[model samples]
Target: MLDLHRLRLLRELSHRGTLAAVAEALSYSPSAISQQLAQLEHETGVPLLEKAGRRVRLTEQAEILVRHTETVLGQLERAEADLAASLREVTGLLRVAAFQTAALTLVPNAVTALARSHPGLRLRIRQIDPEQAIPTLTARDYDVVLGEEYPGQPQPRVPGVSLHRLGRDPLRLAVPDSFDAADLADLASAPWAMEPSGTSPRRWAQTVCRTAGFEPDIRFESTDMVFHASLVATGHAASLLPDLVWAATPIPGRLLTLPGSPARTLFMAVREGAHDHPAITAFHTALRTSLTTLKTTLPLPTTEADPAS
Candidate 1:
């Protein structure tokens, strides 16, 4: 019989992409990880990893095992859930993965609300990018993931994972506090701090700039929304920001709607088979309610209002 624990570690190495990262995340020493993986390969009687220039790469056999490991881990999670359900109590750790902005401004309030309602539940939150969050959630590292999808961009589809739309955050053009640009076209020559390429927000910002008849001169690149706002405030660079970033503290800038008034939809994702798990269901409810309340409190730009008006 294959050892499920070792299989899980192997699966995590594949998802996390580094032995050091896996060790740090799982709280194991790097040498310990190496020993366990070496033992796993010895027991299976196949070479699972190959040394690249600096990092170890998984062999084809290891990739195959990783795929099956996902199934095995998922089944194990389901079995545990079933046992917990049989006991008729929701008492287990719920791990959540979320991006920076949502983690900073939204999730804390939601967690507080959840704790008030369900005192028995234990929660663990991790700050992770949306791109990584989906895959990790599918691998069962996270019970639920808070993810975002920008307007006109294709949302990533993770097989066997289910998504629930929580709320929409309007995207706006953020300019320097004293600068006056009649429209997006007028700011074509302005320096921009954009989300890194391959992210949904970055793609949307580029498309919006193109549609307005100019390509942006992107001077800085980062996925951190707080840093993006700070650049705009300090006159270093302008950017596109969502309403959620302004929820707890207002960014000192002129917020204007894009030509189409685009909005990014935030959602909660879970493994399709584990949707009925009590902890997942409860947290989802709390998140939705918190977002609903936030919509009323956050400062959102009026689509029809002109910045000059």
Candidate 2:
């Protein structure tokens, strides 16, 4: 039988990407973490990790073990939750991982609401990209992960994970305040500050520009919407920013909807069987309520005006 404690350490190491980081996160000395992993490997009778320069990489056998360990850990967590439910209390630590914009705009409100409603529930949050968030959630490091998918660029299917749509956010084109470009075609020659390659927004923006008969000249790349908006404000670069990003920071320039005004779907991912846990259920409910309220409070760019409205 694999030691649950050691398995947890292994999951932490994988999520954090280094022994030192895992140690710091779990409040253990690096040497102690190493010793524990070594003991775990000895008990399993297989090489779990191999050093590559200053960092260590998990072996194929270790990867397989980690996958199974996640299932076992999830089951154990569910069992504990069942016992707690029998006691009629909502209690447990719920760790969440979310992308930047959601982390900045949505999570704070959701967390606050959850805290007010369920004082016994503990919540921890980390900001990371969706691509990294899903894998970490599947590894048992996070109980819930917030994710987004741009229209026409759906999220990749990951087995054993379930998605719950929390809300939808519109994506708009931001341009310099002084410039009055009528359409995407007119802005074809303009420089763009886009998300990094392979991200959904970047790909969607590129497609929109390409459909307009010109390739966008990408001048800056970042996942941060605040940074993107700042670039647009300074006339450094125009961009496609989601409404959530604008909610977090004041836009300094004019915002325009693209020809079709695309939107992205925001969702939560939880391990399939772990959804019924009271803490997880409470957190999900809080998130949905927060997003619904945010839609009304945040300013969304109006539909294309007829030059007079």
Candidate 3:
């Protein structure tokens, strides 16, 4: 029988795209990863990798094995979940990755609730860039991921992960104290601060601007919305920010509800079969409770005059 552990290594290589990355994710050395893949090749009696100048690519045979490995891992997750659910308490470590805003607003409350509700369960979290978060979750580096999707751009479906929409956070135009705009187009020539180029938020902001009939003079680029808020607060630039920014820390600035006033969909993703794990379930319950609290407590704008009022 093939080694299930080695099969996982092969699958991880596919997901992570390099031996060093797989080793870092699983806490092994690159040499060890190479040796294990070599052993797998010996067992199967077929070459499973082709060296491509400092990196390795999986062979067709290795890809086939990874497909089977995915099935096996998923089944194991279901089995583990079934066994865990038969017990009286949920107990395990859950690693989570999230971007800045959710980490600020939702994670703290969820962590507190989980501590009170499931004393035996533990959580480890990391702040990850939006581009890398879900991909890392797919490689089994995280048990769950906090993610957001802007309206009109559905994330492409990733295999073997289950996603649940948490709630929607409204997006609004943030301007320096002196800036004024009756409509999005009025600020066409204004300086803008946005997430770095190639990110979903940057692309979305660009689209929002282009639709308004001019390209923004992008004055600053950063992934941190807090920084975006600061730039707006100080009159350095304008930006499109989400409600979660203020949900974390209230800052003095003008927030305007744009035309259509799109809202971003917040969601969580876990491995497909692993979604039934009791610890994950408990965490999800806590997060939903936090969302409810935000609904009642977060100061969502009622109308254009409300922020001024």
TM-score of each model, in listed order: 0.75, 0.75, 0.89
Task: Report lDDT (CA) for all predictions.
Answer: 0.82, 0.82, 0.85
By TM-score, the best candidate is 3
lDDT over C-alpha atoms for residue 92 of model 1? 83
lDDT per residue, candidate 3, 1-309, as tens digits? 999999999999998889998999888999999999999999999999999888888899999999999999999999999988888988989999988998988899999999998998999989887557777676678989989998677886888888987877778988787887666787898889999987888888899999888999998999989988989988888999987788776754777898875878888899989888998888887887787687568666665332211
Model 2 root mean square deviation, Cα atoms: 5.5
lDDT of 3: 0.85
Model 2 clashing residue pairs (backbone): none
| Cα lDDT over the full model 2 | 0.82
Q: Output the number of the lDDT-best candidate.
A: 3
The per-residue C-alpha lDDT of model 1 at residue 150 equals 85
lDDT for model 1, please: 0.82
For residue 71, what is the lDDT in candidate 1? 83
Question: 278-306, model 1: which lDDT tens digit per residue?
Answer: 78878888887887778767666556432
Q: Is candidate 2 or candidate 3 better by lDDT?
A: 3
Model 3: residues with Cα > 4 Å off, grouped in runs: 17-21, 50-60, 303-309
